[model samples]
Target chain A: MKFKTDRDAKLGYWLILPTVVAISTLIFYPVFYNLWLSMQEVNMNPIQPNTFVGLAHFIDILTDLDFWISFRTSLIFTITTVIGTTVLGLAVALLLNRDFPGRSVIRGVILLPYVTPVISAVFGWKYLFNPVFGQANYFLVDILHLFPQHINWIESPAFAIYAVIIFNIWRNFPFAFLMILAELQSISASLYEAAEVDGASAWQKFKHITLPELKFVLGALVILRTIWNFYKFSEVYLLSASVNVLPVYIYEKAFASYDFGQAAAISAILFIFVLGFIMFYVKKVLEW
Target chain B: MVGKNTILKNIIFVVLLIILLTFVLLPFVTMLSSSFKPDNEQNTFPPQIMPENPTMEHYKGVLNPDIFPFLIYFKNSLLVAFLSAGIGIVISIFGSYSFARLEYTGRAAIQRGVLLVYMFGGVLLVIPLFQLITKLGLFDTRTSLIVTYVVQTLPVSLYMLGNYFRTVPESIEEAAIIDGCSRLEVIYRIVIPLSAPAIVSVFIYAFMIAWNEYLFASVFINSSQLRTLPLGLNQLFYTQHYVWGRMMAASILTAIPVIILFLSIERFITGGLTFGGVKE
Candidate 1:
């Protein structure tokens, strides 16, 4: 039996070997390699030549005001969008959690923003918000009489962030709604029935029962959503080319300027910053 | 008093649902409406909620060679998404089962290891992997995208399958073993048959990830022929600055497959997420 147990353990190690190799090769190695690059001076200009300057790239990115601006934009973008999405998602989930006519259809519709390609959705949104002949400006000016002509949604910093926020909220809420709705479903009818039997009001029951049941899921969602929203790039990049965010800034730094050194520096900054966020959430909220 | 409260609740619920629905539908509705508008009417001074002169010119423009072979990009995206998701499902089935039920010595440790990988966002690894993929001479090809995509998606799918596998009664596998079934036969004949729902859910989740993937696709693929829908649409927007109607048409065209898939698997998508979230 001891010999057989030892052999079984060997078989288990063999079975698990491929997964470890694949993850290490594909994931861990890249991260370590990027860490190496982040420490080097591999700027875009050919005349400058690549140099091994430890922490120089990091120092440069730290001092750059644009990087700080992009960082601020990312923070505002992430916090605002995640909060809005979660709150709206919860409200929608509560509204449609119960049976109604065409509930499934409504649920399906809610997922459209999430399911739709970010590029396509942004394009459509740009058309709608077109300042000149754009439908958004047209509606505001012609119908609502709120504006005179059109508003440049993408060019202006404020509207650019707002548009991106709207897009992000629209895209993500469906996911939150789905998760919360599932949690809502798991809440037994008996709890609500008992509350009603005790003459508890709807709000009172929600506060006592539903809210408590939802806490963990909601907490997890907020953490996960915040992490993802912090790193989100596609919608903002596709929607507003001029309005810079951290990821776009990274892209531009690397590809546009060919400043691989600075790009690596920014990438490292993003990773560390977001990792700090992950640690904070894990400690405080996820308790991982 | 209860009746009045119920009525008020219903009213508030209806109002909330309508507002959420509008938020959800506004982009799609706008896209659909704008797609039919004539080029001149597309970006008019006052946004026309309803197109006065609806034309199919934008759709025609999308089809023309001047803009791009939008259809080809569509096909490329669909192909990549479906193929990657299919490949992912197959890989995870074997890998996940091995992790879950293969009685490996370091199974718990390996599972934790994989979960840690999943928690680290893919963006962190992009630069180095870009170097690796480029060095391998696989850049700008669907094959490269499909292979690397597996790395990011496999962990989540494995986690989902692992959880599902745990729920599956071990007694059944024991019964199969007693019936003179080989390990492979037991997995195929028993496990696969029972885990179709979980498998479908994994497939859909993978499909969503592949379908919505943008960053790598944008970075790696350069050729027009190989470009996925996301990258192709990015080009369309950047290149054709003023072609609002046609851009909207292309947007609608691009979104179709994902929209369809989500609706079809709405139940599984919700269920899978809840199961994975709570159990994890």
Candidate 2:
């Protein structure tokens, strides 16, 4: 029995070897390498070898006004999008939870935005907000007269963040809808029936029964969205480069400016912030 | 009086549904209609909801090799997505099985570590990954993209598969073992067949990640011939003259596969996403 048990353990190790190798090489190595690169002067010029710079890059990033501005932008973008998507998702889920004709079809339709490729969605949005002929401007300025002039929604710095936030909400709320809807399905109908017998109004029943049932899922959704939106790159970058979220900022530093070390330093800082959230997520959500 | 109240409520519900549906579908409708519009009419102010004279010129333009070579980008994307997701799934199956069924030293620690790595954002790793890829002489190559995508996708694949494997009845596999079947045979003959739904869902999830991935593809691939669909479409905007019709057509084409995949697997998506959160 001992021999058989020992053999089973050996086979297990062998089975997991490829995954371990892949994770170690691809994940663990890069994490430590990124840390090391953060502390060095990684000049692209071959003649100028990488030198130990020891916190200089971090100091530079800390002092850079642009970094702070982008950091603020990231915070605002993340908070608004997280709240917007969650609220919108919850509202839609509640509405759809009832038995309506073609509810299933509508449920599938709702997920289109979330599941579509980001590039496709961003391009579609860009066209809608096009300054020259976009329907968004026509509707808002020409038809509704909400604004005096047609705003350059994507190009102008003032409105680009809002445009991106709107796009993020539009794209992500379906995920929230899907998750909340699943949880809603699991809630016993008896609870709502009991609430009705107690003379609870629709709003009161929702407040007492529905809200409490969805609390944990909603909490997880908010945190997950926060983490995702913090590093959201493709949608914002595709929409407008000027928005300058952290991921876009990091991309500009590394690829555009070739300031690899500074990019790594900024990444390290971003990683620290994300690590705090991940720890909380693992403990509270994953319960590990 | 009650009939009137219910009728009013139903009216309200229909109106809200219309508003929601319009919000969701308008962009797509715009993209689709614009794609069919003639080039001259595409930029008309107060953009027409319905095209005056719809034409296939833009689709022809996209298909024209000299203009975009979109077919190559499409092929590259398909190859990379399939290869990466396929490789990731195969490796994850064994790893998840070990985590699911085996009593091994450090198993719990490794699982937690994977979860942490899974949560670690991709942007943070780009610089080092770039450096590493360049050093390995794999930059600007499909292999680099595939390897990176596999790594990016592995954790979630493992998590989903591991959770799934645990749910599968262990007695069946043990019975096979008692019948003198090797563990490998048991896994191949029993475990995989039983977990088809989960395996399919995981594959679709990984494939979607690979297919829709833009960040790494944007950074790592530089040569035009090597560009994926997203990177290729992005370059269209920078060309000397931007063609709205062509651009819209390209966007629609890029989205079709993903839309098909999603519709086909609609049932699994909600289950897969909430599986982790609601597990407890």
Candidate 1 lDDT tens digits, A29-110: 8888788878877644333446788988888889989899999998888899889989988988887777878987777777
Report the lDDT tens digits of candidate 2 across residue range A222-286.
88888888888888999998899999999999999999999999999998987797788769875
Which one is best on DockQ?
2
Cα error of candidate 1 at position A227, Å: 0.8
How high a TM-score does candidate 1 get?
A: 0.91
DockQ of 2: 0.62
How would you encode candidate 1's per-residue C-alpha lDDT over B115-181 as one tens digit per residue? Answer: 7774556566666677777767877889878877777787888888878887888888877877888
Give the range where candidate 1 chain B is weakest over 10 consecutive residues by summed lDDT: B271-280
Which residue pairs in candidate 2 collide?
none
TM-scores for the candidates: 0.91, 0.96
Interface RMSD in Å per candidate, to 1 decimal? 3.4, 2.7
TM-score of chain B of each: 0.90, 0.94
**Per-residue alpha-carbon lDDT of candidate 2 for residues B1-280, written as tens digits (9 for 90 to 100):** 6798999998998999999999999899999999999988988887888999999998998888887778899999999999999999999899999888887788888888877675667888889988888888888999999998888888888888888888888888888888999889988999999998888877887888888888999888999889998888888788953688888999899999988987877787567352453210
